[model samples]
Target chain A: MSDSPSARASRTTGTVRIVGAGLLGASIGHALRRQDVDVVLADVSPSQLRLAIDYGAGRDARDDDRPGLVVVAVPPDVTADVVQAELEAHPEAVVTDVASVKLEPFTELRRRGVDLTRYIGSHPLAGRERGGAISARADLFIGRPWVVCRDEETRAADLAVVEALALDLGAMPLEMTPQEHDRSVALTSHVPQVVASLLAARLASAEPGSLSLAGQGVRDTTRIAASAPELWVQILSANAGPVVEVLDALASDLREVSDALREPDAPGARRTIADAIRQGNEGVSLLPGKHGQNRRFEQLIVMVDDTPGQLGRLFGELGELGVNVEDLRLEHSPGAQFGLADISVAPDALRGAVEGLEARGWRIAGNTND
Target chain B: MSDSPSARASRTTGTVRIVGAGLLGASIGHALRRQDVDVVLADVSPSQLRLAIDYGAGRDARDDDRPGLVVVAVPPDVTADVVQAELEAHPEAVVTDVASVKLEPFTELRRRGVDLTRYIGSHPLAGRERGGAISARADLFIGRPWVVCRDEETRAADLAVVEALALDLGAMPLEMTPQEHDRSVALTSHVPQVVASLLAARLASAEPGSLSLAGQGVRDTTRIAASAPELWVQILSANAGPVVEVLDALASDLREVSDALREPDAPGARRTIADAIRQGNEGVSLLPGKHGQNRRFEQLIVMVDDTPGQLGRLFGELGELGVNVEDLRLEHSPGAQFGLADISVAPDALRGAVEGLEARGWRIAGNTND
Candidate 1:
């Protein structure tokens, strides 16, 4: 169901060199290599480079390799330095870096007096909670937003190369200024991380018994808090300005909520609390549904035995019923022998889907549409 | 693998009366009726009572009926009032109320000088984001912690009845004082709800493009913010003290984080930021895994096509390989034709599980143990 490597390789000719053989770097190499593109992997850490190569990410980079494009995928702190080095080493190459924060490195490079025309900054809003080449996948960027930060000085050809890189990896390329990219991520990513961490941190001193009552709600809220601190420190610090702005606004909101709750019977206190929560409902509603579409699908909950192949038979039956599943979520009671499969389908198809599954001896626990 | 209803009914033989047939009330009726126990459901709303009865929750309650157990399943505000009325109406029956906020209702009843010996307060730590009788399930309490708050004046026989109800519904019964139950839920449930709402509320006034970059991190952090504001307003207000305390601590933490980010190069700023995030990791690590076990399992990622029966085939092969899955999570790339199934197994079984699955033509993406 994916485009063939030969077909992709025919569109862009010449070697693509990737610096920093970490998760993003190796993942890009893997995706490009699958398309039969010549990808040269380079890194300061010899072991990481070798591991990435062994995992079929790319071939080892050599001194004489004159690549058409150079992807700088390194730590945020060193990204500017590496981008500068990559450009200086391969003057003819269109250089792009897949860093989380765009403005910081762009500013740093500009301050260092690096030639700006050949450099195009891009960020693929894609990654697993874990990091490193070992956890990297060739399809990591598939269908995710890959933001390209272009300036007036950026050459059209150079910008085209980065956009094509996103396209070749099956990611949607979005154009934004560096400032817009940083500010946007601060709200969507950085602030959420801080909020989650702060919420989870409260449990540090909580009683053991209290933690036992933790349900999926708190678990989901704090799931990303398990992320490595050192990596987050770097990401957070690099985008500190934008992130701090977001945090300040959130802090003010928190203060108002705390004040309202402290004096619950006061005038407008209930309104304040309810409005804050209602705002949250409005905020979350803006999020696009599956495949980045705004259309809402009805959810049907079907109980499946925890045994093997139960879900398989259920999905097979759904297929036979001609139901196209938009999304699927599986949840299990901690000690129960069965789990609930929340399958989302078109609203019109919900009745037929439920009837068909029920006919197949699958118990429909409940549905959202009802 | 579940015990038949007849077996459960034989152990506790008596009519169980449920008051206020909402989610918890109706769910209790559904579960008890399945065990062939006589269940009488009463509610203020005639239509809701009729709906519950039609859904096989229970039959209508009658004045002539004598109940062995009277379960008060009303809203928090009316819980104490209903409990008092139920006790007055059924003087011989043991009365237990399934209120999320245990302390408020318990105190309210006690303040009115109600008979304390017959009243036991309990909370089942189970619910969907949605509410009402339509969303109720027989297995809602299955494998969940049902906190039974026993006071010093409570009779052993009355306590036993509440515990028995939890057991009959396939829940794990936990004993805690009313104060302990309220504080515990404030940390595990209420605070998380507020934090999620606060985080999501930030997105309300955000730039349209900023929200488009939202990923799974923000999504999970704010998922529960979509919960009904009116319902949560009641829950939060009823237990305002403990919830306010949790929110205050979080507000202080947020302030510190904002300050730290404001001066990223300060002497202790980085340390403070990293420490807060690290504390989050510690807090989450304390959360018990499946079946209330703290032991960590190895996770193996397997790539499966987004088609019917693919997961079934995979699980069947795992079963054939004698692999017991401890937990499972599925993630899909938007617009991708495949999904990654992260299967957790016991550490000692990780090697065998991976090898077995790979041998059966499964593509193992990676494993935590690797």
Candidate 2:
């Protein structure tokens, strides 16, 4: 009830127009329409516009309506053209885009000689495996990072309006330049997607019995491989340089490991393989924990039956015990009748949490601080 | 409670002598000792043996005792030596080792001109990120696959004894040859580990701002990268041929993607990238669903606050409605105030499940079949 669109809409005021009735576009309209602000929707595809309108996203853009802000939410390939069109049509409006790639569109717009003062590029790192207006949600951006790209040419008032939009949608607004945003996403998002897809592709012609022994590690590493291929092609092609840089570095590391593995018994060969893995250990350890905190917590494993209310009962008992669960992970084997719940709690609360859960008849299988 | 070792031990009868008191060895001793079976623990390191005994994994091994089964649970580097010694010392016992690799030891024993009829090679695909008897769990192998490798010379009665041990430890026993086991694990385990570690290694030198946008996808892809480098070096080296084959194929694919991205505007560039990603989709789709069933379920997404009892209330309501949750996944942003709980249910139960939760004031954001 707290995340209801109507409740969130009261915090913002403006006439916002969305120019693409796809997932991001329709979702932005849906989130903004519930607020007191005026919203206009437009799309090249009449059917998509109709669908978004039927879903209560927004009304069709009328020629007489003067929007204060225009959000271009189209595929990366067509993002630059749409942003140019939106800016030309709404000369006074501050324009922003929700494209995943930022620098390419910015460069294209600048190449087209568009006014730079009112344009901002932003990306909200929130999406599902599916796409289209049918899958759009008003709360999709809630609590996710919405990076806003700006430079010295950006006006403070224009930047303020864009930040307000991100805030009204309950997304955290982070500021970065176009180059920085593109490079950052290349490291964190683009490279991982390509690596996952490549790893999964190797299994395409694998022996029939090879996958039967698949465990959680391989499953997690390749989970994102199920994402749409066509969408990724566009994203990867748009930011090819940065993505290729990261992939090349990883490929070099792979070559070293492969060579060392080929001659494992040779002198210093084991050391080569160990060095790469140790680098991985150091890199993964740098990731922030929940709430962007760097501190580690003790994990307590509890076994739960495959019943609907079993997890509910466990959490209820923990809540009654006044233990604050920092994070939680669930692991289950295929065909298993039960699952393991790894609950992370503050170090000081680990003993109390284990005792309380055990007293409530929950079996504590193990606990670890690493 | 059902997974308790005492309840499981009644199904088997034998004395188990474990030859190493590390994580796997100590855990086996702990599990076997809880049952009616007598467990004798030994290790090359006196302090480790003493610690395992103090932790109640098992009693110290006595020379006068005659064990029916001998488990060689040493590191991969010493697996062959330990297995040979165990087989030589206990001539009447059926011997097995819990090393991750299979072919090297089998080849080693064969090269030594030893009679291999009594030695069985097995690997239990269960482990924690950390190692040591202190981090051992009696239920570590519960519902996980424990692969047993045997040759034509192996007796049926001897194989039965090994299978019984796997079952008595609450693990599912799978049968494979030494070659098949090594090849399968190379594809599913070793290759993924290298891929994850290499991907994480790229992040080691990334810009400070790049990691702030790291999402669940990258986090999961690299989670296992934190494993000890020395342990992985031993595993990768032991299965070098098969692992190198997989990595070489993956490297070729990486090169193709990189070349295509470098000249995205070239002829058929987009097609090349799309083809690789499509192959990934096909490969990942072949994975078995939960419970080893190929059927798909409808997923319902519910937003829950970050409070302790919020999940409990949602699950409690589902329980009251008698709706069974087939699978569950939780996603939360780093600093988000709420998390999304995606609960999967049987397709036929979708309507009823949604209605039940909605009636209890739960908001249904969206649902999907994919």
Candidate 3:
């Protein structure tokens, strides 16, 4: 949640031009327009431009209009070309691109001997399963990381303008070099997607009965594997170097695990298996907890009947007791008539929340603190 | 959510003797005792047996007691030995072990020339992160799959006894041969665990800034990597053959993807990458939905404020509207005060639920059906 539009004066000025009226472009248009900033939409496809305009994203760009900012939000394959074109077309304006991968296009432009002073490469780590102008939302970037890749050649004013754009869209602006941005996302996003996809691919040929015994582990691990291949191919190809590095390391680790399992009783084999899993424990612990804290939330699993209002009653009761649910997950089995609602709360609030719910006649199936 | 204790007459008859007194053993004891069945508990550790008894899991084993059914619930490493000992100690009793792997122990027994006519191997696909009697719950097996490995040599009466145990403890019993059980779990459970761990292990050396950019994708893929190494080493080693098979295939797939990314412009490189991801899409679709259906429930994303009562009010309103939420996932950002609650419901209920929530002043951020 953020403040209403125009809660503060806009740091961005003048008419903003957005090329490629797809999800990112249309979303930026919508957010900027919500703040009553002038936005001009442009797309190679007339129908896409019309659709984005009809969605109230922005007005059509006019030939004579002089814009102060240009945003290239096209596919990764065409991002560098469009960014270069936009920079040439609006030489006086600050230009930026919101592609998923930052370094590829940045390097491409540098290789082309293009002027880099007016252009900044950035990526907002925000998206939905579906894409297009039709799926655009004004708040898509709220509270999400928007990485800004800047270099010594980038002017302070141009950098400020890009950061201001991120802030205007409710995104947290994080500065990272092009190399750093590429490496960070390779570890965090790109490799995870590849691993998830490969793992899920294994399941396509799995027997149905074997799949019937699927629990939360397989479901969570492979959920992202359902992403669009067309979109991922472009993104993966763009960040190939870093992505391959991680994938290669992962494959090596997997082989070690396989080898260790194959001869678990052999000297040092069990130790290899144990170390891999133990390393995972240490690695997962490094992740920041929800709410940007290092501590993990205490989880309470409460049983809820499948009937319509059971969860409502439980949450309603929790509300009455002044207990905030920081996060919630509903676990349901294939044949179960009831589900388990795993409610997470701050550590200090766990006891009170559990006691309150229990007193309200809710069964506290289990809790982490217990 | 199952029938209250003794709502129906249990098919399981006679006293049940449970060995090991760990999570599974203690949990079985608790469930049987709740059904008014006499239970005798044993463990190699006296403190563990005392703890289970003090927790009301069961009574201590007596010298003269005769058990009609004996459940060996020790660690996977000693499962065969314990099952063999239980069968020898209770010659008249139907014996079963709850080790994760089936074929290894069964083969071990067969190699020892032990009679297994009274022995059944079953594994309940249920567990918590923490183990031991302190983490045990009577309803651990409710609605979960309990795989029973049976052979032609096993008597029908003995097979029925094991199935009855599963049913009485609120599990669905699925019969399979030891080989089938091993292969099934190797694909579904064991392989996922190894993959998750190996992937998460890559994060150990990653920079904290990179980790700070982590999203739901990484979190879900690596969630199970936190499981105990001591337990997993035994399970993976016992199911090594099948586990290694899947791991080997997965590693091969990863190498192909890496090679493709290394030369994405080479003929068929892009195709290979696309095909891997496309296969993943197909594979993920094979998984059953939460309600045991092939159909996916439509999802609606609603923005909920950080306040204590916002989610409670939202669920309460949905309850009043008679729209049952099939599954719920909360998406929160590190810096955001509010989170997005993605609620899944029946496809037909989408329109009405959206209209109702909109009229109730709830902002529906997005929906899948759109």
Candidate 4:
């Protein structure tokens, strides 16, 4: 959907072979085919390979086909074996594996005594809750980070080929070592998954009445807990070292807070609890906003009736006022006749947007700008 | 805006006095005043009281005024003292305090050996990130759970008055004991706040590059960590017993997962991690949906260009097709020029909505109905 002419022109040259026709593999094939590059699809599961091809991702591999580049997209558990097999089969081509954990596969390949010069480990930060070719989209990787784990021993030409693949798929290529890449994801992705799951697990024995009182807080914190356990088990095991580090730190912090709550009047108990939250405030502020900067957008909550076209009318009026909503969340409790459409706009645009909406008979429930 | 004649007729009769003209207090006053009930506002801060009155929340308290109900909405630390004072000052009035923690104030008043027949502890599960009379809204409690703690010694008439107050504000009144209410909120609210804050505090020392790779998971998990530490410390401490119970349980799960990750190849390690996530799945499923039922809605992610009117056009088309969106979330990456408006509708409406949008020249990126 985001294909650009400049991006299409710089697409990887020559025929490309993809092993493991899953979501990532098929998505790559689709994006590459849009650029008019030749693609060959292969997978251990004949049904999966056939489905990917039927979906127009690519064509089946032929005996005479000589690929210039091979991409491996498979689960982390079998990623190294697939990458090694592809490398041995295509000595003339650069090989890249898009496994979530870069270090494990790279280390496994090196331990197997495979030559690493032609291999580049990569991971694209894009996915859906569901998996397989059915969930594949040509623009899945667009504007997302595609980390390339490169070493000094790698040839520039080989590195360029993998980077070109990322670019052709509309992903921004970022260079990092295998260790750095694993550690980065450990903090940003893996640990959050574990924490969310652990928090949600506590609710298994909770009373339904307790859960009936659940608000946006617990909902936000546990939304990702609905992820498939089979997939996460592999991910957590593959990146165990880094994930363990972050989990241990979180456990220690949790212990201190729990102990303080157990004896709130004890010396420094309140300070300990307060400091944990204060540090949290500092940590969350470090995350980049929509424009990839440390800018804080002003927010307005406009009440909308829970009827068809009410949101359409509100947003339509917002458009007429020339206000661009940077972020939006629609919140409505059960049994309520109206919903609150919380929207964020640039700080400079907050006053005018609020004034225009109020003038247009919209009820401003709340605003951060006030 | 939802001031139905039926709701207005059932409003608490005579004058209603509100102590501590903060967010909750002023919001209660606004909603009650909308029902044509007289409200008198009082606060320690003269400016706050003046501002709340000027905002049409209520009028200045007079010596000649005799209130039939008094609502005490003060900070948790001073809630007990203020409630005791208000009860002593208004012997004939049925007094209710809208403090977050019910057990503390009720216990303190009982410790003072004061008559508890007129006092009913209540909490409306409504708040904004910002506070004060300036943030007050008449419909703040609409369709929200309003927990009222009543004992056997309470008279039916007094309880009826409190229930009427809840109904007049458009809240669903729920009856619970002081202990039960505290425990329920601890499981649903207090512990989640601490867990979120502790998880977010880990990001304070993370590399900026690592933060750049942040995605929807981490963003949702830590969103509530931005809450004010001063307020959270009081909440955590006031309900420390129940909060500690939950936190300890969470810590045990975290330790088990951490240890398993530390030795992923050990026997039963994978099963341990998988079990935690599976239990999370079961736990999150217990929460109700937007329809006040356990119904699962189908989701559709429609891509919208990041322009002023793109969202309006999309929703307008959806309205024309007669689709009622149950919930919506807008997602966009930093450098992406487009955003994805993920909307959930009734499962029965999914096919028609998707087909209608596709026919209208809209790009339907993904849908759960597939």
Interface RMSDs of the predictions, in order, are 2.2, 1.9, 1.1, 1.2
Candidate 1 local lDDT, A163-280, one digit each (tens): 9899888788899999999998998899888888888888888976888788888888998888889988889999999998888888788778878878888899888889888988
lDDT of 4 by residue, A1-370 (tens): 4544235585599999999899899989988887888999999999999999999899999998899999999899999999898888888989998989989999898999999899999999999877898888787887788999899889999899999998888888999999888888898899999888888888778865877778888889999999999999999999999999999899899999999988999999999999999999988888777756788899999988888888898888889999999999988766787788999998888999999999999989889966
The digit string of per-residue lDDT tens for model 3 on B18-124 reads 99899999999988988889999999999989999999999988899899999999998899898898888999999999999999999999999999999999999
Sorted on TM-score, best first, the list reads 3, 4, 2, 1
Highest lDDT, which number? 3
Question: For candidate 3, what is the recovered fraction of reference interface contacts?
Answer: 0.79
Using alpha carbons, what is the TM-score of model 1? 0.95
TM-score of each predicted structure versus truth: 0.95, 0.97, 0.99, 0.98
Docking class of 4: medium
Residue-level lDDT of model 2, residues B130-236, one tens digit each, is: 78888887888888889999889999989988898888888889999988899889988999999998888888888877788888889888988988998999999
lDDT of 3 by residue, A1-370 (tens): 4543346677788999999999899999999998888999999999989999999999987888898899999999999999999889998999999999999999899899999899999999999998989989888888889999889998998899999999998888999988888888898889989999988899887865888888889989999999999999999999999999999999999999888877888999999999999998988888777767776788999989998888889998989988899888888767878888989898899999989988878878788876
Candidate 3 overall Cα lDDT vs. reference? 0.89
Off by over 4 Å in 1: A3-7, B3-7, B348-363
lDDT, candidate 2, at A231? 93
Q: Model 1 over residues B31-136: C-alpha lDDT tens digits?
A: 8888888999898899999999999999987778999999999888899999999899898999999889999998888799887788899999887766778777
Residue-level lDDT of model 4, residues B109-166, one tens digit each, is 8999988899999999999999999899888898899999999999999999999999
- TM-score: model 3 vs. ground truth: 0.99
Question: Chain A TM-scores, all candidates?
Answer: 0.95, 0.95, 0.98, 0.98
lDDT digits (tens) for residues A245-342 of candidate 2: 98888887888899999999999899999998899999888876677767788989999888767877887778787776677777776667888888
The interface RMSD value for candidate 1 stands at: 2.2
The models' CA-based lDDT, in order, is 0.84, 0.86, 0.89, 0.88
